[model samples]
Target: MSIEHDAHASGRPAITEGGPSLPQERRLVTAIPGPRSQEMFARKRSAVPPGIGTTLPVFVTHAGGGVVVDADGNSLIDFGSGIAVTTVGNAAPRVVERVRRQVGDFTHTCFMVTPYESYVEVCEKLNALTPGDHEKRSFLVNSGAEAVENAVKVARHATGRQAVVVFDHGYHGRTLLTMTLTAKNMPYKQGFGPYAPEVYRMPMAYPFRWPGGAENCAAEALAQVTDAIDKQIGAHNVAAIVIEPIQGEGGFIEPARGFLPGLLEYARANGIVFVADEVQTGFARTGHLFACEDEGLVPDIICTAKGIAGGLPLAAVTGRAELLDAVHVGGLGGTYGGNPLACEAALAVLETIEADGLVERARRIGDLMLPRLRALAERFDVVGDVRGRGAMTAIELVVPGSAEPDAAVTGEVARRCHAEGLLVLTAGTYGNVLRFLPPLSISDALVDEGLSILEKAISSV
Candidate 1:
């Protein structure tokens, strides 16, 4: 397929094709999971374990800008971006070129075994690009869970404390420690037992679900969190307070204004490390390079992944030199932590974000999505709330005339969208939120079309 470099007025190349120049428009040649997909799915069921669940079982053969082509040749508009891992889009030109070059040079030398310059370069980029201007150091990992675990390890080593604090509805990762840090119990922590020790959870400043009301959420939540830390787990004993600026899996809940700043002040005064898990909100996905930037929050440590390497399995923990370096030598690292290929792809991804002005693009996406979603909320009583920042937006479904969560309606709306060739995702602690994470490279026309499909789906439901 011939790739064209059609630059927009903003100097960013407008991606109008999927892999092999697959047309950007949605095309349903067969029912979602056609015969071929069904066959493949049957094979997958036989080969893979039941623990691994799939949202849509269609077998994808190719994907790019804003669509994934299935094995049956059906083209579906992609709103999930593989859970915010492809901010620059799948098969992004820069990422592809860099990976190609790096693969030809050498695949992996194992950074721990033989350190490489690409790893150093990636860390340098992270230290320079992360929110603060302080002297920072970073270490790479293979996934968000690893990064979160390492962050906690560093915090403990630096502070000599065992207690780690997290917030309600926050998701860190799936590792042993991260799972303990996570708030949700079902599906994620149901069968898993013997979770990590000394992990404490506090109330989050969730505006829509606050006890009194949205207006009083921030102050109450701050007070509750402070009390929880002071009374439940003494402040001096706490090593770190980890949180997601904009909760991802727990719904795209943006904390009430002033809430994050208050927590930062408390953590600072008490000498506890304030860690922001930006796994899903980092890179240009949240308007700012990091969601904490919205409140000028400079966390002691920031765990980043998802959109870091254009869909590659890469993660990083960027933090102050004193905190990150406090760990003894050889205390942090993994075999595939900073694979050369992923490092190269990350460098390219960073370049793409800057050159494409994707941060502004994310804000533009939010401008287009929020009003429409809010309008839906106005029309449908089931849509209890619509919230999020930049391209990461969501609508929480609830029983009409009540705040009771309506997970059934959420599922129905998502199913309807899938049937119509739109790929949306569901989230939230109660499974009542419909989240949208569209690729920044997707065209406005495609976005409008997707929204139109979503409207019909919601109306039908």
Candidate 2:
């Protein structure tokens, strides 16, 4: 049989922001919710819990560089990157090999009981790599929420304080404390209340909705934070102020220029431990290694996860040695905190990032995605704001001429894209933002292909 190839096709370019090229041309030969996937879904709806089924309804069978192949055999260009969990790329060769080797040797020894070299190595790397040249220490955990909780523990222990401050629209995790830290209330936090006490909510810099320039927005938010701390919850009682440098679940809400600097100053003056939650923005997803680096702000504590181990469940809190040491022995640790297999994967992930120049690649990908998204925003009145850093980005949807969100239309666009074989994620407190998390290693052609599908979806909207 003769093989067919596209005229525009070239050999898969290394470190491309272009898009993905399969070994062969991509062909969606069946309906998106193909027979196989539908059958599986039927069986899943019967056997699996109600919460397990996908909101998009397409059941993925396999995923690689920049595409997801569903059980129905429909090939889709992946723009969500598994919700930013596969930044280096799905099934990265290095991470896969490391996992295989580690699993063969040992899966878990429970680092808390029997420490391993890989765990210490991963922590050492984190301590050295995280911002702040000053002596630092690291503690590993099983998930982002766990990492955030532990950061709070360390801050409280160091400061002998109880209150923690978080901003609106920031997402932490599903666990009790993190759910409380998270901003949105409906699904994640609804009916799960009587949450951990001493947690306070503050306003984040949302320039698109805020009526002013970047400087003015920052000033307003800073003033609000000051008053909140003074009247509602005094800074003297606060342990830490946790923030997402670029608010992830908060509609990719980027803190106004100088806003982060002002928060740092306030934290310093008030003796508050400033925690930068980079779980969604770390590991070069924001062009720089960490979003905080953009402002040269050295957070007292930093929480990271999601993309650290390629895809494995791993999270960490890296902070000043003195602060971390303040926690009593046995204060921070989990049974699978630094599993050997996950640590091995993490090591490989760091290596792949450096060797592949993914940090720089993320920035280039951002440069490419921004213009296309901005163009869409310009054309569509529903497209309210396009914002983000590096490859981490989003397009907020709104009703024409009003800041009022248009989640219904955003959801419709995503549903349409799924039918057209593109995978994207919806975010924001109101669920009105479409965030993009394409793999850093994706090719330009694939990027354009996905964008074309997106353009078509928006046009239909």
Candidate 3:
């Protein structure tokens, strides 16, 4: 079929002529490096780095659906999903076609100078899709970090507050402000030094290790936060309480059910902006389009990225119209924040999510995987806790009953999983948690296959 015809069918303009799709049956003909990817990696290693390139012999010749075909022509089930950036799938047909068309027409005009319909359309979609019955607005950005930074800026600008409240084990981004907001210091904040001022950390309820167990964990955590916001950094002086509905990078820890609501209530009472850092948990990764939707506690601002543009770099802040509008005009944008290509891809991603029912797919992926992970936890002494929402699931590894993390074994498990033809990623302050970001478009068979491999890896570990 012609590209134009396919685009027309998919409700997008055509750009490139017919692009190829991967074969249905996965074929791993050679060792992962095969021959091609190794060559690319060697060439890249001289350019990339040992620190940057964690997965060695890394190069993908082709990827689609839930599998990555490496340069060696080895088809591996992709569970990391490009670090939760490709929820729909790698090279999703709709996203590819839309991006192609957009690139062909015009790539960058920089929304700051000459605005485009795609940017406006994406903002409109975000405003509509984001939780809340109140009037909403959106600001598009390049990456999750940028989105988060801008969200903080908006909150501070609106509330005229100097202090920001973040939770323990929370991760915002790598930027100055975001790094300050991030709880972990090593690597991200270590020597990165002199982080932005006024960023304070509070404890969060990790049911697995909360002093009072799940029953009083939420209340205890809430009391601690309320006290901090009320006494130390008066809520009046605090611009926002940034939180991840399901904490990412901090070990896929889901805040207790009432914890989020409690924080929101505190924010509402003190006129504090509640910022939901849905960077990793947004776009149906948590099964509800936005993880915040699970609690029905609408934040003053919602920072989103990762899966926003199907694979392209796109991030956004969606929230109350008044607060978002509070920022001075032109005070909240980047040169390539909402590039047309990214905007087109994002639109297609939203459509594909709706048309293809990917949110349901995420819920299904979670339903299928969680039980097995729970079972694994029961068997493994190091498996401290298995928790997460929807497709954004993780398993925290600890030393038996204690909260002491086992980063060594966690690293080993991840290494084994990768070697066994399954790509996985680890998170947490101690890096003892294995996070699963499988594509929502993944098939039941692929899910089962990946889990079986994971089971073997964990068993070996």
lDDT of each: 0.90, 0.85, 0.83
Residue-wise C-alpha lDDT for candidate 3, range 332-369, written one tens digit per residue: 78788998999999999898788666777677778889
lDDT score for candidate 3 against the true structure: 0.83
The candidate 2 region of ten consecutive residues with least summed lDDT is 1-10
Deviation of model 2 at 221, angstroms: 0.6
lDDT of 2: 0.85
Predicted candidate 1 versus true structure: per-residue lDDT over 154-255, tens digit per residue: 999999999999988999888899999999998889989899999999999999999879999999999998987898789999999999999999999999
- Tens-place lDDT digits, model 2, residues 52-142: 5376677787777778788767788888887788888877778888999989998998988888899889889998888889899998898
Q: Whose TM-score is higher: candidate 2's or candidate 3's?
A: 2
Q: What is the lDDT of residue 351 in candidate 2?
A: 83
Counting clashing residue pairs in each candidate, in order, gives 0, 7, 0
Q: Identify the leading candidate in terms of TM-score.
A: 1
List ranges where model 3 is wrong by over 4 Å. 1-20, 24-27, 49-51
Ten consecutive residues with minimal summed lDDT in candidate 3?
A: 1-10
Candidate 1 least-lDDT 10 residues: 1-10
